[model samples]
Target chain A: MQDVTITINGDIVTGTIDERTLLLDFIRDVAGKTGTHNGCLEARCGCCSVEVEGDIVKSCNVLALQVAGRSVTTIEGLSKERLRPVEHVTSQSLAGMYAPLEAMGADVNDLHPVQVAFHQCHALQCGFCTPGMVMVMKNYLEENPEPTRDDVRTAIAGNLCRCTGYQHIVDAGMMAAETMRSQPDNSRPAPARPAHDH
Target chain B: MRAFTYLTPSAPTEVVEMLDAHAPDARVIAGGQNLLLGMKDRSDSPAFLVSLGGVSELEGVRAADSGELVIGAATTYATLARMEFTGWHAEIASVCGNLADRPVRTMGTIGGAACAADPRYDIPALVTGVGASLEVLSAQGVRTIEPSDFFLEGGGTSLQPGDLLTAVRFPATEAFTTVVFEKFRQRVFDAALASTVLALRVGDGVIEDLRLTVGATTPRPTVCVTSTAGLIGQPVDAIEPVLVADAAAIEVLGPETSNDPPHLRYQRELIKSVTRRALIRATAIPRS
Candidate 1:
């Protein structure tokens, strides 16, 4: 087993992983954190995306050893019972996109605002693409809180959904942003993360 | 993917020994943004991987004593984005910061990107415009190479098996120039279909120095500075034709083998667009 130290959900977790283990696999099998799911091994699907040191990257595309000293933030950290409003928007984006409210096989209930908007707009029919959609929305919104129509389309362009034509997905993003504005806390940072030293 | 031995060296020199010892069978992983992705798909896997992250000397950016900006091979795009500025700093920073997204750039390194020499990558052209050179260390010792000579005609560099790119340095000058980068990609970060970067030094309604580098259109990024030999003191208006002539010169150097004829046509257009705009932007800036 190879020793690897990676910060997960604001707290650094050290573990021993197989030599060829992937970051997503370690995060799921050994780390016991199921927020990032493994769908397609290729990065074509965005279900494996997680925030690593403030940057949202596809966890599946990286090896666990690569992140040996880096920090990663998964959806598991954003607890509905213990998160701020922006966290709420994030959870809403995830929950709104699917039926059981999960993506990449990781399940969660605290909906990101974008998720809620997706649901309100009836964005998905099969729900296979919601989690990826939610993740994309969360990152896009973080970069551009108020995105244009082109921005919204470009954000979701990589996500393939045969169920819905994607008009609802676009509407959902704007709607989530609008709805979250009604709640003042959504503009705030997720929460005071537990200090994790580099 | 097949399991393999992983080695993280603490020094750049050690990195060379490791790559050489393993030779042809081991992969030097910097950033791992592309290499890891390829491994994940089982497309290619080296028997061993030499992670360069532990080589601290290859991870920072600073201005050299000679006024050249030096970028370590392992310097991440995120770090380069945050690097302190000098004379044409904003243009370089803006282009790099705007690359891929916050995520990919966070792990992508300038050396890796430059060495990978992916046609879509902007650093090749960015550095070429600035007249940058790279510090490469092998078992033989260290050798510095200009951007023009570093990139080969196959979408990658001419890096020998054990040659580790140490840093990239550019001659610092107060020439306030005009530079513009334009790219056409299928998606936000899905590699480039065509991209171009043009940088020019202008003054007193006359052209001083200009560098136009086009990526994706050719196997490796190529600089069209042939006409720069003639534009030393030519008027700004007269420089456009010279720049066009330079672009034509580039089109004739290396045959486009990475793609078919139709695709080459699109890339040629991008080279033209960026060449034209770069000239316009440089003219707009006040001469220093």
Candidate 2:
């Protein structure tokens, strides 16, 4: 067993797990955060996607022991920030990113724009792939606030959705992009993340 | 997946010592994209898994005194994609960015991909095309292996049992050159059926130096020396992508001793078309 400490959902958590425990298992079992679903167990399905050190990764592929001293963000934490819409935050705070959602007329009371766009565009049929898609797009749209339809397709190409034919997902991503870019440049600071997190 | 003990060493020397202590039972894991997949399939079940993530020596891209870009074996493709490189290495960035998807690219390392020696992988051929070499270390000593001698059959490298791949060094190229990589897959994230990497230098309207490598058609990254030789002395105006493609395809698929003739024939056709497309795209890049 290895003693590991990881920051999840902006809180530091520590645990001792088998060397072979995968991050997906640690998130679902140890952290009791089942929002990050596991579909293929393998990395092929994007359902296990999460943010590790500010980059999107498949939790299933990363061993729990490898995530020591790193920061991880699951769908649960991401959805919370989106729902709460933290307006005042540090330059690197992940929570501060949602300020643009307000500029795009995203309702703090309802689902995030990416989520709202998904529902409005019918991006999800069974909803199993929605969390991964949202996680991927949240990170993607933040980086590329103005994405073309082809750009959105390329961004989510890794995520495999067996339903909705991906046409709706692409549409939702573009719609989210429109709302994300509506904010003035001065209104947004650097991405809300700690400089040392990555 | 079978349970295995994990060991994380902070230095390369420690890694080799641990490898020496645990011979065939130890497996060095960087990124774990390929190694973990093999482990999951029960094809590889090492008693001890050595994680290279903690080794600071094997973790960044730097320039060597010899003007070669030494990329630490553990440097992720996601990092490589974000690097600002000019000329031929730009092609490398493009290849790294487009390989698999964002998640895999973020996790897969160039060293891991090269050491895995998967015939269908992009880095092996990309590194080979740019004349890169591997720096390997073990209990015995250290040595540099060229791309031609590095890759082994059946998704393995020349790395001996106790050896660790430290870094891959890419030699700097001349100006007036362009490199391009093209991969053909059924889907965006699927493995390549055939892949091509081309590095061409044209000067004074004449072809100067060219390195063309094709992957996924064979057990290793196949350098099209014969095809390259055909274009070396030719003028840029007289050269054609099809001419080089045909030579590369013929060289890859010899007419002798066929165990699986039909598969070889189909692959040969893929080699030609992919090579031609790669060459055309490469030659079209505006010379800087």
Question: Per-candidate DockQ versus the true complex?
Answer: 0.36, 0.59
Instruction: Compose the digit string of candidate 1's lDDT tens values, residues A1-198.
Output: 788888887667888788788888878887788657677766666667777766666677678888788887776654444433243345546655533333433222345566556655777676766666776677777666777777787666556677788787887787665655554455332322222221
Number of clashes in every candidate structure? 16, 5
Over B1-288, each residue of candidate 1 has an lDDT whose tens digit, in order, gives: 878899989998898999999998888888777777777668878898998868888877777787667778888887777665755766677777666755567678888888777776777767766667889999999999977688876556878888889998866756445666666676675776656666666667776776666666667666665545576688766666445734544563444456547655565665666566666566556443
Distance from true location, Cα of A63 in model 1, Å: 0.5
| Residue pairs in clash, model 2 | A92-A192, A92-A193, A93-A192, A93-A193, A94-A192
DockQ of 1: 0.36
Q: Tell me the spans in candidate 1 whose CA falls farther than 4 Å from its real position.
A: A5-7, A10-16, A32-35, A82-110, A121-125, A143-167, A170-172, A175-198, B41-43, B82-87, B173-176, B225-229, B241-250, B253-261, B286-288
Stretches of candidate 2 off by over 4 Å are A81-111, A184-198, B153-155, B256-262, B286-288
Which 10 residues in a row give candidate 1 chain B its minimum summed lDDT?
A: B245-254
Alpha-carbon interface RMSD for all candidates, in angstroms:
2.8, 0.9
Model 1 interface Cα RMSD in Å: 2.8
Q: DockQ winner among the candidates?
A: 2
Per residue, candidate 2 scores C-alpha lDDT tens digits across A11-109 of: 887888888888998888888888899999788888999999779998888898877889998888754434543465443553245354465444533
What's the C-alpha lDDT at position A89 in model 2? 48
Q: lDDT score, residue A1, model 2? A: 77
